[model samples]
Target: MNRNRRRGKKLSRALVTAAMLGDAGTARRLLRRGASPELPDAHGTTPLYAASVQGAADVVALLLAAGARPDTESGHGDEGTPLCAAACWGHAGTVRLLLAHGADPVLREDHGTGRAPLDWAERGPHPETALLLAAAVSSRPAAAP
Candidate 1:
């Protein structure tokens, strides 16, 4: 099936697939046709989340530029944030990109346990990635009252 011919929810799914595969072109086309960057898969992972997890820096950038909220959480509880997903997989570039787009490192909203992005990054074996996350988190300004 031609990806361009897909419609409605199908286009949304295709967008997710494209984001997962890091196919920036197809994802761009789908987004142009109204496929939401915030659309979630059955697992509740948004296209941006998928792109972050797969280390698709370009796709992540495209999604972010398309208005995908950097703080949007997935369905896995406290581990579902786009930042957490990227950090878990040790995608340093993706993590940096998300941070640049305003992803909160301390956001532990809904990702399973209450783990923040830095927590997830620490769980991985990538010390450099963990260091980056730590720096980003520590460098964050305190929330205003």
Candidate 2:
């Protein structure tokens, strides 16, 4: 493999690790060095998804600002969208950030028996997160049947 490509791959992996660790400074530095926020880790988890799942609001914000898609799906089947991950963990702040970035609260998991972000939030018993997701869902136009 090309040297530059190899470096980029390493940087991408590092970015995902930093995101998972909630190390905003490291994540920012990696991003500045050209790490792709959308690049998936070896496990298929994107930086945004990892950050969201960990409730790393700062890292999540950085990733989103760095061009990470708020609704980007990550992880293996049934792992769901970033919004769902945030909601599942009851990360109200992260959920708010994602919603501000246009995340669809009604989006379901990619695999069988898909569940929406609201379902995840409710399952978490995260009343605040659930409310936010509910409002977002109510405000949006219904999906086409």
Which lDDT value does model 2 have at 89? 91
RMSD of 1: 3.9
TM agreement with the true structure for every prediction: 0.86, 0.93
lDDT of 1 at 26: 96
Give the alpha carbon lDDT tens digit for every residue of 1-145 in model 1. 4655445568778888998899999999989988888877666768888898899999999999998999888655423778888888999999999999888878885644477888877888778789988898789888799
**Each prediction's Cα RMSD?**
3.9, 1.6
Q: Clash pairs of candidate 1? A: 76-111, 76-112, 77-110, 77-111, 77-112, 78-110, 78-111, 78-112, 79-111, 80-111
Candidate whose TM-score is highest: 2
Q: Give the alpha-carbon lDDT of every model.
A: 0.84, 0.91
